[model samples]
Target: MSLFSQAFRPVGSTRADPVLVALWVALILVAVIWIAPFVFIVFTSLKTNTAVMGETAFALPTDPAFSNYAKAWARGNFSVTAFNGVLITFVKVPLGVFLSAMAAYALARVPMRGRRVLFLLCVFGTMIPFQVMLAPIFKQVNAFGLINSYPGIVLPYLAFGVPYQVFILYGFFSAVPKELSEAARIDGASHFTIFRRIFLPVSLPALSALFVLDFVATWNEFAMALVILQDPQKWTLPLGLMAFQSQFQRDYGQLNAAIVMTVLPAAIVYLMFQRYFVAGLTTGAVKE
Candidate 1:
């Protein structure tokens, strides 16, 4: 039998299984729909501006121009901007996760007055949209002379990052058996020691997941970065991509190249941590 027939046909049968064939066809269609734009961007990045705008936007580049990436990188000042993004992501994500984890541990493990109220307040903070806080945050940043600086941007990232991380970690910490902590406590382990040695190690999957998430969110964030980072030197990759696109508005190839560059780092970061992310997500799905 031909490969096509074999693929669509059920074993021990001369004809295709209608249900399997339909499902396979639907999957292929969805896959194409999902991947079409990325494929277009790759093709477009190789074509000239005229070709991109011309009748053959979907056509393969007849005269592939590979220099667009080099040109976009140079024009976009991506080296510095990408580095700035990495720096900000590296600094903020760890701090945010650590702080959030600590808060979560206390909320989950410690008995305190008004704990429910405090925990609900943290959850409530997440509901307040970032857009609503923009004006007030900008004002506060300016008042504290944090505007036009890295700390200014980093601090807000941490603040916004903490609540969600805490919420997630809180659940994980809660799910941990209290018997372990009790055993360690009977051995004279301090709260800090127990947390540092026990809770953190066991929560690696969740922490890894949160780290990946916060890193991407901080990296792609544009509105606050644009507002606070006035200097061109401190612009992150997303801001740099926007500025590059505007400056080379007519150069679709360059624009697409810049976009590809902007996307690559985040994609790589996600891929690197994807295993842990998926594991962490499934950690709490079933009872032990």
Candidate 2:
């Protein structure tokens, strides 16, 4: 059942269920709690630094300073950093998802030795914290003279991102009926053809969902970009935001404006893929 239907579904014939009412209340409370910071940020972004510092955080701006966004855009060098962020996110996320999807397909459909062990190892990799691998990743990237380059950052992102992508896609892929593969094979469809034409097409929801998630993660990635991209010119949005914060520490208005700018793209991407997200996540949850 759809969430809306479930949420409003009446018990018996007369009145609302107390349990459902309580759940609705709890959900509203959680939504408010989650959105409160964003609301504060928006309000602060429109206020003067004086107003931001003097007034309560939740206070509405007495005099809305729309120029704060202009100042932030210019001072934050958002044009350049936004370009870099877009480049990295667009380049890294789709490529990572595609590669991970192929890996997942192999593990799911292909006959291979120790596939279970390999899948287990991939799952194990997700457990290893990125911090633990940072030094070694930096060392390797530096050894290859990739510091401050896009590849340096993208490679690490793929490495860290793949395990989880595979974990998700593997379950989705495995759940596909084997008869489909058999039928495809009987029609002389190659494994690559089957994967590209059949599997990928049917997995649109999962792929779209992964793309949105990975796009957001890649766009907001900080530590890896910080370590790999030393040059200011190559800094992504998160790193640029950090620099913006440091340079404009006392300018709360501009700082919050910069934050809103940084968050906007990810939010846009999420909304674009919102329809597929819940379905993708619950793809294999129940078997008929």
Best by TM-score: 2
lDDT of all predictions = 0.88, 0.91
Model 2 stretches astray by more than 4 angstroms: 1-11
**How would you encode candidate 1's per-residue C-alpha lDDT over 143-211 as one tens digit per residue?**
999987899999988888888888888889999999999999999998889899999999999999998
RMSD to the native, candidate 2? 2.8
Report the lDDT of model 1 for residue 126: 83
Please, what are the lDDT tens digits per residue for candidate 2 over residues 1-288?
A: 256445676866455566777778899899999999999999999999789878998988999999999999998898989999999889999999999999999999999899999999999989999988889999999999899998988899999999999999998998898898889999999999999988998899999999998998889888888888998999988999999999998998999999999999999988988999877877777878
Best by lDDT: 2
Residue 116, candidate 1: alpha-carbon lDDT = 77
Ten-residue region with minimum lDDT total, candidate 2 = 1-10
Residue 17 CA error for candidate 1 (Å)?
10
In model 1, the Cα lDDT at residue 222 comes to 97
